[model samples]
Target: MKRLFRILIIGLSTLALAACSQIATDANSLFVSELTEKEDAILSIASDKSFVFDFHIDSEYKEASVWIEKYEAGKLVDDRLAHLTTEVEQSGSIIVTLSENTNENNNSFNIGVGTDENLTSINVSDTDLIGLESMASVWGSTSEKVAIDNGEAVLANISYSDDENGMHSLTTDFFEDAAGHMNELEKYDVAYLLKVEFVK
Candidate 1:
């Protein structure tokens, strides 16, 4: 009876090993082999306005999706901005509209997604305020541009204070861009940042 019990123990151990191996294989199958290639297709927008943009992609079980968000004055504005769910046949896309809030001399805007899942691309366009016009020259600098590119998932922490305030009539124009970088991958994820500052 002791020898039979030993044999049963060995059998159970072998079965456990097999189950673990199967689980690993299943996990590996969920990832796409060429994720970065598709991630690079996303285009970068110039950071010359008051809005910032960020984008990223994530995958599971051979399926992938994208997430995007935006902010203003250190506060989240786009809570349900956009999303894309990837599949075998076709990928899905989500687009969000921006709402404007005008209250006396203080105008505000917002953009973002409520979910933490991966996102394919995110684009943000805001009117160029007078406060950002003076900083236009700085936008062409490489370092500032790099900062904008890397600030997508963060608040961008960019702001300017006014000393003398008297009806600062602000005006801006809308900008547009897109990304199809993750199309070639079967599974993958990528993230990016975009920043725009307005000057007068």
Candidate 2:
């Protein structure tokens, strides 16, 4: 009788785990399907499909000076005229920058169309900025897709978690160079950072 009871418990645990797995799979499918639909529609109707490089870094940017700010510390510094001039090519991983000592916040960045059907990919590469946290979609967009960043916040948190090792990482893998079904025409406004003062 004891052996039979043990078997029953084991069976129940297995069932529970299997159920959880199924649930996760189903949820992911639904999410991906929805995202694909929206992205397809957006791309289908997009007028300006040219490869665009809209990036700016603060002129006052000093290497390793702008540390990741803590979550609770409100805007510590501000800078106007922080956007420095830059030259960008069609589609490749070029380091774009933003700085607190500039006009706009660097952490919160944007990526999207430029000017026909020239651009074929979404700019999904490494970034050398602060951090990210989820809120009402990344940067106010609805299709906040999966991201593989060095060790920053990840929305679509349904898929991944923060890297355990706390190292300064500067990379993001969104729609990597026409690899995914959803290509360009998706404007990305990422807002996933926890600001802190300069760290050691």
Candidate 3:
């Protein structure tokens, strides 16, 4: 009986390991980006306009959150410019809209995530937030330009802190990787999406 129990335990362990491996494989293809100018060195847009993102998500994900990160000259400036959490249906197209507001010396941005309508909208307008000089500079002149590194997205659920800046910022330890990079996503039965882009 002892030997039989040991065999059973070993078999269960192997099955568990296999299941973990399958999940890792699925993660790689869970999110698909459909940006037309993804490879462009710089994506130019009006300071008071919105950029729309159309992507594909696996049917397994029913709920997800999308956020943005600002980068300048190959460095991170803001990790949570905007965040939107919403529910998703089966495998289909997911649209995320990022709207920027830089008027009258005031800088802010909003994110909307949903299929055909704005299911969730998150607005962020804080002066203390980093990576605003670019948007601020473009308020008065068209020749002035500020460039950032690039835009990328990841999937994971993370914690945020609103007490610091009156807006949400990454405050969870598990959301980062060993190198303290925001790309290291932490999963808590939900999905997180991020996009980083530099203006040149």
Candidate 4:
């Protein structure tokens, strides 16, 4: 019986070690591979008379043109929205949209972008109670541009204050190799998305 028990323990130990080794070897591919750019869009609009322009792209956008027209007295008054050019990431897609927010007899336009789960969000505060409110953005080299509402405080050093709401995150191929994995990380085809609603 003693010999049998020893053998059983040794077998279990070997199996556990092998499982761990396999997990370590496969972790890189399982979590980091097959990433492709899915979206990227950037639109710059210029106009007078303070008119609001709202645009939204559900998926990847190709080369496109933007036109804004002004009207007066039931006729075309001016169509001088010019000097516009579109520059998009060669592989990724970013959806952009605009909406109206009314607050205390005031009007503002809200911009919204879509997002994914791969984002590395850091919770600054650990509590059910909420804290101060402010607007902030967290950015990194590989990370896509993200916007957030009032929640966690952004430190001057770009770190973070507490793990709270409104805290932003990072996502990209930068993390795969940076974490000391075997596979090299490359820019994913899918770009991060941004969306929000606030009284302006």
Which candidate ranks first by lDDT, i.e. highest?
Answer: 3
Q: Compared to the true structure, candidate 3 yields what TM-score?
A: 0.37
Candidate 3: tens digits of C-alpha lDDT, residues 1-200:
22332332233333333333444333212332223352121123322323333333445555555565544432455667675557753222222322333333233555544443224455565354333333211111011111211123332222222223233323334222313654322311111234422111
Instruction: Evaluate model 4: give its TM-score.
Output: 0.18
For every model shown, the clashing-pair count is 29, 14, 7, 24
Over 4 Å off in model 3, which ranges? 1-47, 91-104, 116-118, 129-200
Candidate 2 lDDT (Cα, 0 to 1): 0.22
Better of 1 and 4 by TM-score: 1
lDDT of 4 by residue, 14-45 (tens): 33333334443321111111111211111122
> lDDT tens string, model 1, 126-159?
4433443222111110111112122122222223
Q: How do the predictions measure up, each by TM-score?
A: 0.23, 0.16, 0.37, 0.18
> Can you rank all candidates by TM-score, best first?
3, 1, 4, 2
After superposition, candidate 1 runs with Cα above 4 Å error = 1-60, 88-132, 135-200
lDDT of model 3 at residue 57?
Answer: 40
Best by TM-score: 3
- Candidate 4 — which residues are off by over 4 angstroms? 1-60, 89-200
Candidate 2 wrongly placed segments (more than 4 Å): 1-34, 37-72, 76-110, 114-116, 120-200
Model 2 lDDT at residue 118? 20
Better of 2 and 3 by TM-score: 3
